[model samples]
Target: MTERYSRQERFTPIGPGGQAQLANKHVFIVGAGALGCANAEMLTRAGVGKITIIDRDYIEWSNLGRQQLYTENDAASLKTKASAAEQRLRAMNSEIKVQGIAQEFEAETAEALVDGADFLIDGTDNFQTRFVINDVAAKIKVPWVYGGCLKSYGIVLPIVPGTTPCLHCLIDHLPQEGSTCDTVGIIGPAVQMTAAYQSAECLKFLTGHSMTVEMVYADVWGREYSSINISGLLNPECPSCSRDAVFPYLKKEKGLKTAMLCGRNTVQVRPDQLSTLSLSDLSSHLENVTDRMKENAELLMFHVEDVRFVVFKDGRTLIHGTENVEEAKKLYQKYIGA
Candidate 1:
C-alpha cells in the first residue's frame, strides 16, 4: 500500500486495486469555482494522477467564501480560477500532474479539452456550457458527473453514455421556477456537498465500481434529501444522445454578443464576429480614462471610474465592476468602438 494513500486504500470500497486504477487517470473538470475547486482538491488529495481544470472567469471577493483553493490575493489580483486551482492542487500533490486552461470551453473548444479525458465533471454555472459537455461526453463515450447547486440545494447525476440518461434527458424534470445562486444566494455547504458527490461519483467510475446513476438531490438548510432513479427518465429521442445529432453549442465560432461571466460582477462584449484589433493603436485614441493603462502582449486594460475593461486582440472586451450586459456593451462601444 502506498504510504500517502494508505488510509484511502484501506477503505474496503477502494482497496489496492482501485488505488492503482486512480493513478494517472485524466479527469477534465470544467469550471474552477466553488464546486470545481472543492472537487479538484478532493481528487488531488485522493491521488488522481492527472487533472485538467478549465475556467474562463477570474476570481473575486465573493468567491473566497465557497472556493477552497483561492486566497485573498488571488481574488484581488483577478487571477484566473483554473490557473489558481492548478497551482494549489500541484502543491497539494506534487506527484500528480495538473494542467489549467484559462479559456471558455465552448463548442469550438470542447472536443480538444474533453478528448482523452477518462471522466468529465461539470462545475460550470450555465446550462449552455453543460449542453456542450453532454454532447462531447456522449460522442466520446466517456462517463461524466453533472452537479448543480443553488442557494441551499444541490443535485448530482452520474451519466454513463450507453447505460444512463444524459443531462439533456433531465431537462424535463428541472425546476420550472426558482431563485438562482446569484439572486437567492448559494451557501458554502451546498457547494461542498455537490462537489463531494461529484468527486465520489468520478471515483466510482474510475475504480471500475458500479456507479449509482440516480439524481441525488440535497438541501442543506431544509434538511431534505432524495434520490430519483433516472434510468426510466432517459429520453429515447433526445437529439444529443439518442440520435447523435450535431451539437449546436459546438458549432460556435466567434460572435458572442453579451456574455455574463460566472461569480464575477462582469460581462463580456464583442462584435458579432471577432475582427483583429490593434490594442496599441486603440490606446492612442482613448481619452478621459486613467493615464496609467495596463498593457501586455495578450491584452490591454484601462479603468474609467467604476468600470475597468480588458481588450483582447480578438475584438473581445471583459467589462468588470458591472453585471448589466447592456452597460457592458455600451462601454464597449464608447471605448472599444461600435
Candidate 2:
C-alpha cells in the first residue's frame, strides 16, 4: 500500500509535483453520504495531507448500498456518517490527517467550517446546505466543487469564485423538499460518476492546474454526457456571486428550522437558539427508552415507535420515517425534551 499513489503520480497530469502539492493541502468535505465518502476515499488514497469531514446524519442500512465507507455494522450500530468516514479513510491512508466533525452545516458555522481549507467539496443532498457552502466559499474566495446526483443523472461544476459562474447563477432557487430527490431515485453509478468528476476537479484546483472543462453533466445509465460552457450563465444580479457579497441564503430569515428531507422521508428541525446539549447526559436519559440507541461523540440516536430520532449536541434533530414537519417536531419535543 505504500506504493498506492505511485500510479496516480505517474499520470502526467498529476505528476510528482502535483502530488506533492496535494500532499500539503487541506480539504473540507461538507457531507459524508455517498458523494462525500467517495471523494474522501479518492483524495485520501491520492495523498491529500489533511481532510475534514462534516456531516449531520448517521449511517442507515440503506446507505450501505452506495455510501462505500460503511459496513453493515456501522449502520446496525447507528454510527455517525462523518465519524465513520473518517475512520475508514484513515484506515485506508494513515499518513493523512482525517478529522471528522459530527455537526450540521448551516449559516452560523459555515465560515468556521472552511477555515484554513485550500478547497471545498459539496456532497450535500439539499440545495439549502449547498447554498450555505457556496456563500461561505464565495465570501472566503475559496474554490469549491459542486456535485449532485439524482436518479441516473448527475451534475458536476467547479466554482472558482471570481473565475467562474457560481451555483446561484445556474440554479436560481432550490426546490421544495420531498419533491426534489425523493421522487427521482438515484442509482449507485450516478453517485460514483459525479463524485469521481468532483474529486478530479478538486485535485486539479488544489495543485494549481488549469481547469479547461466547464460544467459536466452525465446520465450514466442512459449513456449520455455533455460539457456545457456556462460562461454566459454568470448572473451579475445574483446575490451570491454579484460581487455585492450579500448572500441571501446565508441570512437568518432565509433559513427554515424545519423542513422535509429530499429522499429520506425525514424532516430535520434545528433550534434557532444554540444550546449546549450534552449527548452523554441525553444518552443516560434515553437508555431506558430503547436498547437500540447508540451514542457517538456528538450524536445520540434511538428509535421509538418505528420512528428514528437522531439528536445532535447542538439541539438539532433529524427524524426519520416521516416527512410531516409538525409530527417530527412533536417527536423531538417528546424524546429530546427540546
* Cα lDDT, all candidates: 0.83, 0.86
Mind sharing the TM-score for model 2? Answer: 0.90
Q: Specify the highest-TM-score model's number.
A: 2
lDDT of 2 by residue, 68-137 (tens): 9999999877788888898999899998899999888888888977889999999888888999988888
Task: Write the residue-wise lDDT of candidate 1 on 128-225 in tens digits.
Answer: 77888888988888888999998899999989875689877767332334455656788999999999999998999899998896889999999999
Name model 1 segments beyond 4 Å from true.
Answer: 172-178, 270-284, 287-301, 312-315, 321-323
Tell me model 1's lDDT, rounded to 2 decimals.
Answer: 0.83
Residue pairs whose backbone atoms clash in candidate 2: none
Tell me the TM-score of model 1: 0.89
Give stretches of model 2 more than 4 Å off.
177-181, 253-256, 278-306, 334-338
